[model samples]
Structures are given as C-alpha cells and as structure tokens.
Target: MTLLGPAEIRELAASLGVRPTKQLGQNFVHDPNTVRRIVRAAELTGDDVALEVGPGLGSLTLGLLEEAAKVCAVEIDPVLAKALPDTVRRFAPEHAGKLHVIEGDALRVDVDEQPTALVANLPYNVAVPVVLHLLATLPSLRKGLVMVQKEVADRLVAGPGSRVYGVPSVKLAWYATSKLAGKVPPSVFWPVPNVDSGLVAFTRREPPQEDRNEPSQEDRKATFAVVDAAFAQRRKTLRAALAGWAGGPDVAERILRAADVDPGARGEQLTVRDFTRIASQRQSQAPHG
Candidate 1:
C-alpha cells in the first residue's frame, strides 16, 4: 500500500469525489520510485522532523512519515484533504500522532518554526515562495527537499554565469546550498501536468552566511525593490533598472563604482555576492533617519 498505484488512485478519486483543483494546481505523485527517490534525497535520520506542503492524498506524505521523526503536512484541497486521514492512517499506523495536517493555502498560511527539515511535492505555483518563506523567514528550519517545476529547479541551483540565474538564484545562495537531485517525467502524476518536475534539496547553514541583516529583512521592500527593479528591465544595466531606487543616474554610477560592479552589466550577469554587495551598499548609503 506504499504507492496506492495509478489504478487505485483513479478508483479512490472516483469514490471520494476527488477532482484536482485547477486553481490550486493539485498534481499528486503516485510513482513509488519517485517518492522513494524523494525520500532518499532528503537524507533524513530518525531525529529529523519534516514538514510537507500540498500532501494530496498523502502519497509523498506516506514516504516521508516512514523516514522522519515528524511529518506535518499542509494541504489546501478539500477533496484531497478529505481522503488524507485514511491515507495517513494506512501508511503510518504506528506514528499517526506525528503526522499533523493543516488544511489551508500554503501561501497564505504563516510559516512556523516546528520541524527541523521541510519537504514537499509542491504545486508548481507555490514552490518558490513556500521554499523562500521557510528558508528566509523561518530560519530555524534546517533542510528542505522539494519537487518544483523543472525549470525553477534549474534556476534555484543555477550558478551566476548560467542563463537560468536570476533574483531567486541569488537569494537562494544567501542561505542554503541547493542541488538538483532528480528529474521526474510527467507520466508519474495522475492527470499529468503539462511540464515535468525536478527534485531539489537545500540544507540550511547554521549561521546562514547571509548578512543576517542584509537579505534577512524587516521588510524585503528594499531587497525585493532592488531585485524586482533589476529583473524589471533585465536586459538593461543594473544601474538603469535601479534608477528609481537610487534617485538619478549620477548617484547610481557612484553606487556601482562603490560596489565595483560593471555599470554595463544586467541583473542576469551578477552573482549573489554581487547583488548582496549592492544591497549592503545601498543600505549603507541611505540617509540616517
């Protein structure tokens, strides 16, 4: 019963009136090999506590519960939510108490410092924000194993010089060292999604080498303001894109010189270190208020 396989999944879907929500982007992974690979990639010991998002019918949830000490799942779909109790019960009869479920929007739900590791077969749309929320906001969470859109998986671990590098790649580098673990074909999912999926794992640094002050923000207004603006006109130079944040062109040049970034470079070309330096520089130069 570890997999609940494709035919059974279809049968259960019919019996439970479980229709995947188009708006919620619900895609359940029922392939046992993929689920096992995801569990193995997490590299959890008995001591590890894991949190999962969108634990639809608890497919991945069952695999996680077997490995980790605790598995707290947040599922947003009512149809799948209704089916999860039996799902959790069947796979984790021994540790049923350890499997907690929170039924709500993963995006809207505030992240908490509960488990040491957070992992999920996340819906494509919520993948980055949920990962960032746990990594950037709930710094106490030690590790993450996620199934994100294949392209986003590329971007998360993409190096500065690579084509996929952008604001998220830079931000991710400030905390955990991410690696693409596995690529999953579309056939694994029930009613299969248009795009493929990829598995990525992130282990949080104990002290998070990030400024703990720079990217770790009271309000990411300045960092995001800078990042959003830079990517706004990604082909334009960082200075040109940052014109609104730095006032006029003259000061932008001075800031670029101060940070030692090329005045001609665009957001795509800069590494996390480069962006971090620029953000720190901007924070320093702002008027003392």
Candidate 2:
C-alpha cells in the first residue's frame, strides 16, 4: 500500500479545503517512517479488526489497512470522513473493501463489532479519556499502540509512586498494561505541534480478581469514586481527602485502617488494588444486614 507523504498530504488537504484545526487537535502525520513505525508497533495480525480514532486524512488508515483484516476508522470531521473512502480507493484500491468509516465522536461512537486491536494518532486534547472509553467499551481489544502527546504518554504508563502517577495511570492500569514504545519528532506532522509525540503500547489484561469473594460493578464504581475524591484534594492525606466520599473524616480513617492502608498516605501512593480494598471496606461498613 502507498503511504501518504508531505506532497500527497498537502495536495489532498488543499483539494478538500482542509486546514488542521487547533480545536480538533489535528496535526496530520506526513512522515512515512512514522506511520510505518506506528503500524509495526501495533503488532496487528491477519485476524485482527482494528479500530482507529481521528484518522485525519487517512495516513494511518492506509497503513492500518495493510496489516489488519478490517480497519474501522472513526472520524469526527465530516470533510475528512467523506474524503477518506475515496482516498483509500485511489491509493489502495485492493484494500478498499477492508475499510469502514464512521463519522462521529470517538467517545460516543457505538462500535457494533468488537475490534481485536486499536491503532490511532489520537487527538491530544482528549487522548486519555478516549483510550479509557474504547478499552471499556470493547472487550475484544487484546492489544494496540497509540501515538499521543509525550506528557500524556508518560502519565498513561506511569506506575504507583511515580511523580506523574495519578488518575490516568491508575484508571488505565485497571484495564491494560502500558509502556512508552517510542518517540516521534515534531517534524513529522503537517502543522508541527510544539511538543514531541510518544507511542504508548498496551495489552489488555483481566481486572484484578477477588480471591474469596467476587468484586461487583458497584465495587468498581465505589473504587473509582474513592480515586476521584482522593485526587480531587491531592494535597490532603487519605483520611482528610476522602472525607466527603467516605461520609466523614472519622469514617474515612476507619475505612483506610480496615484496608490496612495508612490514613496519612496521599492518593498518588495507592494502586488501583488499594483503592479497591478501600471501596470494599466502605461497602462492608455500610448499615446493612
């Protein structure tokens, strides 16, 4: 398949009257090497059905079509969405049948068929939420690679106790294991972003299992609530930070103690499992029976 270069990209954009918009975070990738690297890092197999978000100008989409059995691209912009199919037909006619385009918001798009892998140059502004949402919505996504802003990449792959560890890190850990695969220079994009981009590669894993009792959906909700509340006041210790979430400071202390976590510890120090334990304690202490 022919990949889009600087000339072809510019020509297509000019034809469609498309200019990269800051609001959409549209920095189109024009480097052939960058697109090839992203596709290789994704590790797509012949059986894989890939879901690509914000496929601006079909650069990555063309690369994905080369590897994946089917490429379902979700684009928010109507012009690019309409132009993508014809571009594919012109550039990679043999693979045209493998391409499916969905014109809508990635966050709200309903994917009827579960994609075996995800590959995208995600919009920098909404990268974290979009990744988290797709992982939660599609159970069959076993693995994938995404190119995002460098700082966001660090946060997504950050582990407990790391300086950047917080909400994105913990929540992402609840679904998949992630690592920084590589970095892309700013020169690769059409409207070069000020900051570099990093590739975050991830493999989905089962949620932590309960040894004796099964954790329910309510347990997940309660744990996420604790996570949000704890980070909402990052400066405060767990006992004080979770006061409103756990009903009060005293009750929060008891819950922390029951979970065998130190009440003085801050939210950044706790893992998703620790938060789950705190949630379990809260549920147990509730007036029931």
Candidate 3:
C-alpha cells in the first residue's frame, strides 16, 4: 500500500481544490513513517473495526486500513468524504472494500457498525468534546489512540492534583485509563501546525462507583454536573464552588461531608470516585418527588 508523502499530499489537495483550513483543524499528516507509527501505537487486532474522525485527505485512514478489519471514517467535509473511497481504491485497492465513509460531524454522527477501537488525527479545536461524545455514545469502543494537540493530551491523561488536571481528566477517568503515548513533530504535516501534537492512548473500563451495579445514564449525567460545578471556579473550595449546584453553601458543605469529602478541598484535589460519591450524596439528600 502506498502511504501519502509530503508531495503526494499537496498534489492531491491541489487537485481536489482543498486548502488546509484552520477552521476545520485540517493539518493533514504527510509523513509515511508517522502514519505507520500511529497505527502501530493503536495496537489494533484483525478483528477490530476502527472508528476514525476528521480523516482529512485519507492519510491516516490508509494506515488504519492496513491493520483494522474494517474502518468507518467520519469526515465533516463533503468533498473529502466523497473522495476518500477513491483515494483508498487508488492507494490500497485490495483494502478499498474495507473502508466505510460517513459524512457527518463526529460529535453528532451515529455510527451503524460497531467499532471496537477509535484511531484518528483529530481536529485540535473539537478534540476533547469529540472524544468524550464518542466514548459516551459508543460503548463498543473498547480502546483508542488519537492524535491531538500536546496541551490537550496532557489534560486528558493528567492525574488528580496535577496542575493540568480538571474536567477532562476527571471525565475521561470515568470511562477509561489514558496515557500520553508519544509526541509528534510539527514538520510531519502538509501545512505544518504551529504547536506539536501528542498521541493519547486509552482503554475503556467500568465507570467509577462504589457498588458493582452498572452505572445508569442518569448517574453519569449527575456525576458530570458535579464535575462541571467543581471546576467552574478552580480557586474556590468545594463548599463555595459547588454551592450553585448543591443549592447553597450550607447544603453543599453538608453533601460534601456526607460523601466523606473535605469541604475545604479544591476540585483539583479530588478523584472521579470522589466526584461520584458527592453526586450520589446530593441525590440521596434531595427530596423525592
């Protein structure tokens, strides 16, 4: 299979009248070695059906096709989505039948085929929201390796108490364990991005909760509300930060105490489990209708 190199990438884009747009976060990967490295890091099995988002110019898509049993690519751009099948046919004719292109926003697209893994060169602007939305909606996604902005990567994998840790870290922790896989240089892209990129690798796990019971959608929604509230004002203690969410400062303190959390603690100091516990306490204390 012929992977797209720098010249081929520019040539193809020019032929298609496609200019990489910052609005779409369209810095297309042009290095064949980088593509191979990303695919290798993903560790997909032959049985795995991969879900790729923002597959601009079919660079990483071709690499994913090499390993994954099936690839469902969601492209927001109509032109790119329509052209990907042809690109695959020309570059990897044998694997053309394995490619499925869905034309829609990754955040809102409902994929028909059950994809076991997510592997993509995500647009930097919507990377976090896209990842969170997919993980929430696609329960079949057991693992993933995504390339995103370096700063966003750190936030995704950051631990509690880490300076970068906040909503992304706690929310992602509810779904899976993530780590920084590797860093990519800016020179690997067609319209080289100013900032470096980083690979984030994650594997799905059960949501954090005290009991063995399966977490309901309501439970997750409730926990996330608490997470949002806690980090809304990072400098404030839980008692003050969560006051709006819990109704009042006194009520917020009561809920925190009930959850066995310190009211004086800041949101950055707590884990996903702590947040879940606080959500549960708030629910228990609320008057049932």
lDDT against the true structure, each candidate: 0.77, 0.91, 0.95
Residue by residue across 1-289, what tens digits does model 2's lDDT show?
Answer: 7999999999999999999999999999999989999999999999999999999999999999999999999999999999999999999999999999999999998987689999999999999999999987788889989999999999999988899999999888888898999999999999989999999999998776444656556766677888999999899999999888877888889989999999999999998899988888888785322
Model 1 over residues 1-289: C-alpha lDDT tens digits? 3566787677777888888876787887778888888889889889988888888877788888888888878888776766687767766677677777777887677656378887888888778888877776566688888998999999999987788888778667667788999899999998799998998888776422235653346334455566677887878887788777677656666677788988778888876666666666677785322
lDDT of each residue in 135-222, candidate 3, tens digit only: 9999999999999999999999999889999999999999999999999999998798999999999999999876678899999999
Candidates 2 and 3 compared: the better one by lDDT is: 3
The residue ranges of model 2 lying beyond 4 angstroms of the native Cα positions read 211-215, 287-289
Clashes of each: 0, 0, 0
Between which residue pairs do clashes occur in model 3?
none
Model 3 / residue 60 / CA error / Å: 0.6
Per-model TM against the reference: 0.91, 0.97, 0.98
